[model samples]
Target: MRGLLTVCSAVLVTVLTVAGPVPAAKAAEPGGGDIGEALRHVPGLTVVDEAPAPDGYRFFRLTFTQPADHRDPDAGTFEQRFTLLHKDFSAPTVAYTSGYNVSAAPNRSEPTRIVGGNQLSMEYRYFTPSRPRQENWADQLTIWQAAADEHRAVQAFRALYPGKWLATGGSKGGMTATYFRRFFPHDVDGTIPYVAPNDVIDEIDSYNRFLSRVGDDPGCRTALKAIQRDTLKRRDEFGGLATADAAKKGYTFTTVGSLDKSLEIAVIDAYFAFWQYQKQSDCATVPKAGAPAAEVYAWFEKVESLTTYADQALAPYVPYYYQAAVQLGSPEAYDGYLRDLLRYPGADVPESFVPKSIERPPFDHFAMPDIDFWVRTQGRRLLFVYGSNDPWGAEPFRLGPGSRDSYRYFVPGGNHGANVAQLPPDEAAAATATIRRWAGLPPAGPEVTARSAPAGFPDFDADPIMTARPRL
Candidate 1:
C-alpha cells in the first residue's frame, strides 16, 4: 500500500501542549468496553481532542508520556507523548516520511509493531508535494526537516518513553526515516528504513548504464530473453493470467520477446528528466499532436501487461530474450533493433516507461546494492521486523553515522505487509504494553507478532535480517 505519509512543507506546524489547561490528565477514550476499560486503567493516558478522520470515526490522540525535544530550543519543539516513564524504557519513536505513498485512510496496521512490547508512538504524519517536484525538491527538504524538528517526535519518545527501541518506515517513508536517522541521530534510537533509494542522482544516471550492461551480460540476459520468447509463442494459444506489464515485471512477454535490444536505447529517453524528452539521442518516443488517441491507446494495450509487475522487477523473461538476441545477432542488427523514440506515449499518453514521481531513473543493471550502515548513535534504539520474501524488507539500511542497534526480526514466506498478521495485531497494542505504556483508544486490536528478518539469502542487498540479528 502507498504510505499514508508525506512531507508537508507549506502546511506549517508546531505542536505545543496547546490545550487551554495543561491538564493533569484527561478521560479515557470511549466505546472500547473491556478493552476500552482496560485502556482507561493504563497509566498516563489522557484523552485529548477527538479528531475526525474518514468514515465518521473519530481518532483521539491520547497522551501516555509527556515528551520533550532534546534538539536545540530554536531547532524546534514538539510536545512528547506521556509514556516515557519506565526505568529501562528507551521510549522509541517511529517517524514515517514516504516518497509518494500517501493514503488519507491509512490501513489499520503500521510498520513498527515488530518489536512488540516496546514503548513508543506512531507519528502518523502526511506530506504530499505537488507534481514537478524537480523544481521544489530542495525546498521540500527543508519542509521535511522542519516537520521533524517541530514535532521533535523522535526525541520525545526516545527520552521520555522507556526501553530500547527503533524507528522505521518503508519506501518514501523509508527515505524519510533514513534522513531522520542520519540527520538527527541523537534524536532517534535505532532505524530500519526499507526500500529507501539513497544516492538519488547516481541511481538515476546509472539506469541507462544498467540496461546497457544487462544487454552485454549474455547468460543472465539470455535466460530472461528465452522466457520472453517462450511466452510469446504460447501467448496466442492460451489466455494470459496476467497483464503485459505484469509479465515484464515477472519476466514474461509475448512474441518479439524481450525488448532487451531496444529497451537499453529507449529507457534513456524515457527517464532522462521531467516533462522533457531526451535530446542528443533520438530514442525518446512521443506522439504527434494530431495522432489518433486510439493509436496511442493501442500501444499501451500491446505492452501494458509488461508493466504489471513493475514493483517486482523488469519482466525477467523478455529481458532474457533481449540478452540472447543481442548475443546471437550482429552488432548492426542489435543497433537496428533499438526501439524508435517517436511520439512515445508509444502508445504512451497519460502513461510512460517510468514516471517522474519515481525520483530516479530505473537502475536495474548497475545495482548499488543496499549495505547496512548500522552505526550505533548516542540516544538511538530500534525494533526492526520484516517478512522473509518481502523485497523491501530484504534491503539493507544505514543506521546513520551515530545510530544505535536494532531488535530486528523476519517472518518466513510472508509478503509485503505481513508483520501485522502476526500475533500482535497492530502498532497501538505494541505501544500500550510498552514499559511505560501510553493511553489511547484501548490499544486497537490484538498483540501482534513483531516484524522479523528472513533467515537466508545472505547475499541479498538490503535485507538487514542478517545484519541486525543477535550474532551471539
Candidate 2:
C-alpha cells in the first residue's frame, strides 16, 4: 500500500503461459490424480507454459477463469493470472496473496526462501490482465470475490502438492492473505502478514499520532512538520517548481486539476512517505527555517516527488483505488494541520482519489470491520509483522488476551520493509521455530538473514528499532 511504484515495477507485459515439457496427447481428459493431471483437469484452469526456474524449480504461468462475482454464478467470468515456482511436489509451499498484479519476476518472498519450499503467487482479480472489462468492475471487485478466487487456486494446488502449505504477504497483500484464511480456514497451515493495516476510516488520526511520537528526539518530529508547513506556506514558489518539473518530465495531475492542488497533495503525501520509508539518518536532511525555498523543495522531492501521483502513476492503480473505495477502506489524508492553507478541501476524500474517467461504486464500510472481528476471534496460527515508525502500523488487528494462536512483531524504527528476520535474535529464532513447526519441517540449515534497508538508509542493525509486542 505504501509503495505502489515499487510494486508496479515488477509487473510483466505478456499474457499468461506455462513453459515445461509437453505430456503425450491424450484422448480423454485427465482427472485430479497428479500435479500434471490436476493442471490439465482443473475446471476453467489451463497451463500455458513452463520453464526451468532458479534453485532447481519449475516456473509456470497459469490462467484461471474465475467467476466475476463468487457469490453469484450468473455474473460471468474473467481470466486471473498466477505463477508457480515449483521445487518439489512434496516440499512445503508458500502462497503469496499479492495485493496487486502478480509480477512475472522471480520469487522474492522471504517465507518461501526461508522454508526452502515452492512458491505460488496469485494476482488479485480486476488488476491488469486479471481485470475484467471496465463495465464489470462494480460487480467484480469485492473482498469476498478475491478471497474466493484464492480459494479456487488453493483447492487446485492442494490436489497437486501434498506437503504442508503456508500463506504470506506484505502491506495490502498481507491483508489479502488474512482474508483468504478467514474465508477458508483450512487453506493454509499458517500465515505471516507484514505491515498490514486494518484501517476503518480516520486513518489520518492514527498517522498524525504516529508522526507526533515516532523519532527518538522530538526535534526530528518538529523538523518534519516544519518542512510540511513551509512547503504549504510557500505554495506559490514551491508549486511553480513542481509545475515546471512536471512539465519537463511530461507528467500530468489529472485527478487533482491545478498545479497548486498537486503541490498540496504532494506535501501531504511527503509527510506520510517520509515516515513510511525514510531512515533515521535521513531526518538530518530536513531544511531549517532560513533555508532557501529551493532547498526545501529539493527535500520534498527527495522524500516524495509530486510525479509519483501523476496520471502516469495513477493509470495502473485505477482498479486499486476502486477496490479501496469499495470494500477495502482507505484512510483520509490528514488535512487538519494545513486546513487553513488548503484550496481543494475534498482532495483527500477516498472517492476523490479515483480519476473522473472511472466510475466509483458506493463504499461498503462493513466489509473490513467484519474481517477485523473474524481474524481476531476465530483466526489461528497467524503471525503479523510491522514497523514501529511506519504510519500504517496504527490500525493493526486487535489481538485480545484470549487470542493465543495469533502473534504480532513490531520492528522498532522499522518502516514498511520490516520482515521476521529483522526481529531481534531471540525473537527471530522464536518466530522461525513457530513457522518451522507449523510447516511440519525440522529446523535445518540455510537460516534467514536480516534484510538491508533501502538505499540511503543506515544498515539494519546500526540503529536497531526494538520490537513493540511481546512473544505470544
Candidate 3:
C-alpha cells in the first residue's frame, strides 16, 4: 500500500489530495500488443492487409475494434463513419498522440465506445519501454517514448491503404501528426496535427513561467492568492477535485512531487528566470537589487529567444518520467532530480540561467518537425481547437511560428480536450467537412467552419467565418 501510494503520488503531485476512497480499479484489458487492432477503418473503405512487399518497405493492415466500440443515440459507435479505424495509411492517418507528459508505460491513450454487441471500453494502452518498472507505476511513461511501440500500428495502417491522406492526432498526438507530415510528407497526402504543442520545450518552461507570473506579478499574484483563498475558504463549494473526487476514486493526482503550496511556491523562485526568458521579459516586473535592472533585463531577453516551445512543454514532464526519483523519492530528492534536469547537454544556458526548453536535450529521435514547421514545410491544412477557460490555453500562440497558429481556430470557453468534444453538433460536423475536404474526400455537407476566432482577451484577431483557403 505504501509503495502503491508512492507510485501514484509521483505520477500526479496533487494525487494525494485526490486519492479518493473508492472501489478498486480493475486490471487493464489484454491485447495482442498490437495497437493496429484498435484503429478501425470505415466499414465501406476498401481495406487490405500485410501482403508480401519489398524487404525494406513497410506495409499497413486494416484492423477492427470489439472492445473500444460503444453505442449511443446521438452517434452509434459503429453507426457513423468517423474514421475511427486502425488503418495503416498508404497515405497518412491521424497520429492521435498524447501531450508532453510521462507516458512511459502502463498507459491507455485510446478511448473505447460501447457499441453494437461489442465489449466495453477499448484503449491504446502503453507499456514501459524501460525495465525494472513498478506495478501501477506512473513515472517514465512519455508520449515520445510511445514511438518505440508505434511502428506496428503505423505499418498496419499503411498496409490497409497505401495512398490515403492522413489525420494523425491531438495534443501529443498532434506532435506525432506534425512530425510524420514534416518528416515523411510523401508517405501520406497531408496531416492535421491539431492542438499538439510542436514547441514542446517551450510549453513546459513557458507553463512554469506562466505559473510564476501567476504568483510573481502583482496582478497575477493577486489572482492566485485570491483563488487560493477563495478555494480554501469555500473548499467544499469548489468541488475540491484533488481532495474529494481524485482521493475518493484513487484515480491518481495524489502525489505532491516534492511540493506542497509552499514548496511549489519556492520552486517558482527559479522558475521566474525561465519565464522571463520565454515571455521575452514580459513577465518581468521591477527587479530586485541582487541583479541590476539592465543586467536582469538583458539576461532575460537572451533566455527568451531560446525559451522556444520544446523547452517549456517538456521540462516539467521530465521529472515524472523518472518514476523512482519522483513518485518514491523524498521531496528533497525529487527536487534535486528536477534540478539535474535543468543541466541537459548542449544546454546553452548560463549557470545562473535555466534552459527555457525541457531540462533534457531535444529528442527529435523520430526526426519530426513541430506544428508550424510542418505547416510551412508541407503547406498542410489544419483545424486548431482549444478552450478559453483551460489554464493550459492561456498562452496564445505567438513569438515563433505560433503567432500564426491563429490561422486555425481559437474557441471560447474551451479547455484542453473540451474544445473539440464540446463543439455544437452542427459546428463540429462543419469542422469535419473542412477535414474531409483537406483529406481529398467529397464534402458531405456545407463546409464546416474550417477556422474560427472566438471573442476573447486577444480579442478575435480576424473574422472567424472564413472558409479555409486551398493550399496557396
- List candidate 1 segments past 4 Å from native: 1-57, 60-94, 111-135, 138-167, 188-227, 230-379, 392-395, 398-403, 418-446, 450-472
- Candidate 2 lDDT tens digits, 1-472: 3143223222210101111111222222222234555567666778977755655666778888776776555666778888887767777888896577775644547677667687888888877888765346676677766777777777666756767999988777888898888666787999888888887543334666666678687888777777778777877877788878888988887786766776777777777777777777788888986579878877876777755567765666666677777777666676677788787776854465577776666676456665666566567899998988788887787775545578889887788778887788777877877787788977644265445432332342232111110000
What are the per-model C-alpha RMSD values against the true structure? Answer: 16.2, 9.1, 18.7
Write candidate 1's Cα lDDT for 41-77 as tens digits.
Answer: 5444554444343342223344433212222232222
lDDT values of the candidates? 0.31, 0.69, 0.31
Give the higher-lDDT candidate: 2 or 3: 2
For candidate 3, what is the TM-score?
A: 0.39
**Native-to-model Cα distance after best TM-score fit, residue 166 in candidate 2, in Å:** 1.2
Give each model's clash number: 91, 9, 95
Give lDDT tens digits, candidate 3, residues 1-472: 3354334324432322221112221222232223333333322222234333223222333322111111112221111111133322232244343322222121111111000001010112221112222222232233322332232233334434443344344444455444444333444443444444333233133443434333224654443233233332332332332234334443322122211221222222233233221232233442333443344334322422111212222234333333212211111111222333232222221211222232333332221223233354334454555444333433432223423222345444343343433466666665555655555555454322322321211111121111011000
Q: Where does model 2 exceed 4 Å of error?
A: 1-43, 200-205, 289-298, 401-404, 444-446, 449-472
Name the top TM-score candidate.
Answer: 2
How are the candidates ranked when ordered by lDDT, highest leading?
2, 1, 3
Question: What local lDDT score does residue 98 receive in model 1, on the 0 to 100 scale?
Answer: 33
Global fold similarity of model 2 (TM-score): 0.83
TM-score of each model, in listed order? 0.38, 0.83, 0.39
Scored by Cα lDDT, where does model 2 land?
Answer: 0.69
